[model samples]
Target: MDESYYKYHLFFCVNTRSDGGPCCGDSSAPQLRDYAKQRIGELGDAIPGNVRVNTAGCMNRCAEGPVLVIYPEAVWYRYQNRADIDEIITEHLCNGRPVSRLRI
Candidate 1:
């Protein structure tokens, strides 16, 4: 991998349940993940391989629900919808500053 990149990676937990436990996909994991991936793709292409966005199993933070983690920076976030995901991508991933309002 190229060292010019900041080595940032974001992982979204997409756990689901029939019994109703807290999960990232519980509210809108698929939508969020899709949005995240698409937004990252849109944003990262400008930088060309600086960040990686991915799907995860549980992230062991189900209690927090709708959780996502960014590595190297190790920032954790809880989001409600596509708008939040978009903000994260625009304000944090693209700008090098974390979205403090959404951090969890």
Candidate 2:
């Protein structure tokens, strides 16, 4: 099989609903997404292949706001804070192991 374009492509949903509704942006997805990007930048070559963290519009999983999806594997995860972001980076992105507890 061919290698993935980016070993891990992370898409963080940062959409905020017009009316009152649960949304990733309202749940701090942007901030956490930035944090994840910074952390990955710091990791540099320590991580395999190229990892791209991007901001995405609504994934329609509003009830599960603050959601992030990793490509190639298409693993979805819901995170609360920086610590959870750290866990994802360390375990999944770095170690090639998905964090079962965070899977959504």
Candidate 3:
């Protein structure tokens, strides 16, 4: 099969629910997603391929809130702050090792 365009594709669930239910948006998924995107851009060639970070609608794991999935490995994680995001980038994105503590 042809190689994937990006070595890693991160999809952050930024869906917002108006029914007073838990959602990724309510957990600052968008802001966190933006931060991850910026961090990836800053890494440049340190990571393989063109790492793409995208916003996704309701990954159906709202109960997990602020969830993100990294493709090529399909590792899923739940993050709460910049530190969590940084760890994922540093340990997973840049180093090819998934952050076990944050994995969901």
Candidate 4:
């Protein structure tokens, strides 16, 4: 068996909007997910066997828009941009503390 370091897995809800209702697509889900992946790699913590950034179909929190859920802990977040994603990566992913300001 291979060893893994990351204790958390994050998933962004990139569900699209077709009915003109609210959804992650209407916000910054794509950007956030991309930013997260990049940041993780840049931090040298993006081991495919440990941490993974994935796109989810729907988290059922469309109203929140740009929703991301961290697993192995299952913390949901609502973000607005790169800064929020950064905070999550730094505070939550790296430091093991959830960013209460962005919790959803």
Residue 44 CA displacement from its true place in model 2, Å: 0.7
Candidate 3 per-residue lDDT, tens place, 17-97, comes to: 999899999877888989998888898988767899988999998898789999989999999999999999999988899
TM-score of 3: 0.95
Best by lDDT: 2
Model 4 scores a TM of 0.87
RMSD of each: 2.5, 1.3, 1.0, 2.8
Put down candidate 2 lDDT per residue, 1-104, tens digits, no spaces.
Answer: 67767889999999998898988888878989999999999999888899999999999888977899999898999999999999999999889999999999
RMSD of 4: 2.8
Off by over 4 Å in 3: none
Candidate 4: residue pairs that collide? none
* Backbone Cα, N, C clashes tallied per candidate: 0, 0, 0, 0
Query: What's the TM for model 1?
Result: 0.82
* Candidate 2 segments whose C-alpha is farther than 4 A from its true place: none
Relative to the unseen true structure, what is the C-alpha lDDT of residue 96 in candidate 3, on a scale of 0 to 100?
A: 90
Name the Cα RMSD for model 1.
Answer: 2.5
TM-score of each: 0.82, 0.95, 0.95, 0.87
lDDT of 4: 0.83
Candidate 2 local distance difference test against the native: 0.92
Query: What is candidate 1's lDDT per residue for 1-104, written digit by digit as tens?
Result: 54645457888888886678776767788778888887777765554347777888878888887899988778999898888988888777767789999988
